[model samples]
Target: MDTGMIIQHRRSSNIHSLISYHAHVGAVTSIAWNLFYPRVFGSSSADWTVKIWLLDCFTPIQVLDLSSPVGGLAWASSSSTVFVAVTDDGRAHVFDIRLCKTRSLCTQQIRQAHWPALSCVVFSPFEPVILVAGERGFILSLKLSPNLRKLHKEARGADEEKLKELERQKMERIISTSAIS
Candidate 1:
């Protein structure tokens, strides 16, 4: 299977099967997993829609209406709490994936994040932080709240250990020069 494709391998027979998930009329561009439910999320290139599928039933759980072709997708770990998607038109859409039917009740949108098409979007390893990458090597860091933003800024700018290491190296260089002289 490809990087985005999910596959199941049979141990005994060494046979692999592609997990039958969604029925998309267009090419499936990206897929993400729902943290709360046994489901997978996917986006289509031609249809410009996001689809959620139940794992066991292999059926589409929901479809999100979008205007541009989807380029990337990600989900929050808090179970139907937040889902993120980027489009070729440089728009980022965040939505609630809590619904069971093929429709979402509420939606939130972020637009024009990149000048060109966006390539990928993912949640930070630290949680509540979203990382987006796009064409021209564009990258964006987004925080869910002001508190999260403060924490992220601190983490990104923290340099205590590096400073200490630099000091140690300078001292060692000085000592070596003195001994040589």
Candidate 2:
């Protein structure tokens, strides 16, 4: 078992790296397996690229290269085709992975999202909201416009009421840990 690669455990207390997907040239910065779509996952690397792959296969479905290294990636918890990737140059990109016609380009991109460097990008489980964190402890919250139609509106404050509701929902979860951490 290669310790540096991602492994998944399904339906049991067993862990395994299903395939040998050496998807990056340099250090892999982040990996995100879609919580809802079991077959899909995303990875970012210091090699200046973001790669998306499917389970049971070794090669990435698509790769997006940038001028700077990518340090963070996350799949949208609510959508089947949406994901976010952050670069070391302080930019966060929103991509519709299903857009195979142009996998090298992003559907929407947010630049200068964080000073120094952008570190992470995460999507809300319930709403079209994104949270970003980076250098100097700078944190930002942006709500995707209707249906993720707009990524340029504004990086406003979070909605306290909705966030509280989501927290309440999580408090009700009752399950076992059966997957990769």
Candidate 3:
């Protein structure tokens, strides 16, 4: 919102504008409603905060703070406990915000963006796969099994090998393209 307030509208009825005011200090950039928890939704703003709101509530149940402004935000497709937000600095921050919780905290990040600011991020409805859109004209679909617990193991083993293999494949493609040209 231009006045730093997030509003909700009712659908399929004559009624409209459910809430009169919200708690963002700057222009709100994005908003998302959880697929599983219809009463729960999220709002992100240029004020560098993300707020979790229950339906028909004026005060937020949770608020996440960041240094830079968030560009996009979305709730997990199937899980009511999961949510994520993306920023302009090539990062996607994830959170575990189940309902009736007292405090808010960030849980994880999807992955580093493609070396550019990310515009948006969405999770697949069926699986844990995530799609991230970058401002540098690219969209990356990543199958991230790199959970916080699995990350160390993957980094020590699978991830390094995969990175080497990908680098080799890129070099081969470059060489073949140069020869063709």
Candidate 4:
């Protein structure tokens, strides 16, 4: 078993420990930081769960159970509340927290059962596609449908700052609702 810890360091000083907790019962397989929100990140573990965390909290805001070992995970480049986690059983679990927090919005079978386990998943920054890699030297690119790529919309001529704030608020709402539930 491995514990998850966050650390911060400056160029002129030694690394300082921030918060440490038992994030998983098994080894953590992958960790990804949300591109749109600096304070939010996610971790997947062999315990068959993915946990979403906030920088200021020790407990995870949400835990998703996949019922199989998670090989890797990656946050979406265009949305703060969306991510994909690959499992050892050759399934790709796509989650959009804004739509549903209890389960993945969609699950795709990227590889056959006889094929090697998927090792990693990454989202394309320029498009609504994801590339999944397997342990046996195979890679598959998947194009997300319109439903999976749905994102919050801003008014016409909205500034960049306003868009960013909307993204931040979206994540904040999920976090707050998770706390209550």
lDDT of each: 0.57, 0.64, 0.64, 0.85
Clashes of each: 0, 0, 0, 0
Q: List the residue pairs that clash in candidate 3.
A: none
Candidate number of the best lDDT: 4
Runs of candidate 1 with Cα error greater than 4 angstroms are: 1-15, 18-22, 99-114, 145-181
lDDT of the structure predicted as candidate 4: 0.85
Residue 10 deviation, candidate 2, in Å?
8.8
Residue 56 displacement in candidate 4 (angstroms): 3.4
List the candidates' TM-scores in order: 0.60, 0.66, 0.66, 0.88
Poorest 10 consecutive residues by lDDT, candidate 4: 1-10
Stretches of candidate 4 exceeding 4 Å from the true structure: 1-15, 155-159
TM-score of 2: 0.66
lDDT of 1 by residue, 71-153 (tens): 78887643243567777876677664322233333333544653767778988756677888876787988766642223222
RMSD (Å) per prediction? 17.6, 9.9, 16.8, 2.6
**2 versus 4: better TM-score goes to:** 4
TM-score of 1: 0.60
Candidate 2 lDDT tens digits, 21-131: 677777788988866555667788888888767676666666778668887898776545567888887777777644442453343455554356778888987777889
